[model samples]
Target: MIIHVVAIIMELLKLINTFFESALFKKLINRKRSLNYIQFQRADHFLITLSKTCKQ
Candidate 1:
């Protein structure tokens, strides 16, 4: 009976760990995507500025 209880507890812990890790991974991915988007926008602005300067 004790062994069964321990096994169940271990399974529950594993499931909880998995859930947390998935959530953390999704958060990281979203952060990375946002960073990339900002960087791209900055690059686009820089290119526009360079083109305008060249035109002058």
Candidate 2:
């Protein structure tokens, strides 16, 4: 029946949406981690420079 076909299509769409949502969530998490790492490296570099200047 048409109703069954429509129901199946809706389920497929829901599954696809769930998959994309998880994928996007993972990408966002990775981006945040990379950003944090970059910030940490910059802070470390600044501290090293500050120490060298103080020593000089």
Candidate 3:
């Protein structure tokens, strides 16, 4: 029973490691980075627009 439990734990760990190494995981990370970048870009644009409107 203990050996079976250990085997299961190792399998789970391997699965988790593979998931981390997968392209899907990398895409998820990159997606977050891009989202952050887009948010910053949007904020910069909004600030610039606000300043222009205020000046006008």
Please tell me which predicted candidate would have the highest TM-score against the true structure.
3
**How much is 21 displaced in model 1, in angstroms?**
34
Per-residue accuracy of model 3 over 5-49 as CA lDDT, tens digit each? 656755665676588678997787787877775775686577557
Q: Give the TM-score of candidate 3.
A: 0.49
Question: Please, what is the whole-model Cα lDDT of each candidate in the order they appear?
Answer: 0.63, 0.63, 0.67
Q: Which structure is stronger by TM-score: 1 or 3?
A: 3
Error of 2 at 20 (Å): 34
TM-score of each: 0.42, 0.42, 0.49
Please write out the lDDT profile of model 2 over residues 1-56, one tens digit for every residue.
96686567556656754764687756865778777657756865775575466446
Q: Residue by residue across 1-56, what tens digits does model 1's lDDT show?
A: 96686567556656754764697756865778777657755865775575466446
Best by lDDT: 3
Which ranges in model 2 have alpha carbons more than 4 Å from their true place?
Answer: 1-32
lDDT of 1: 0.63
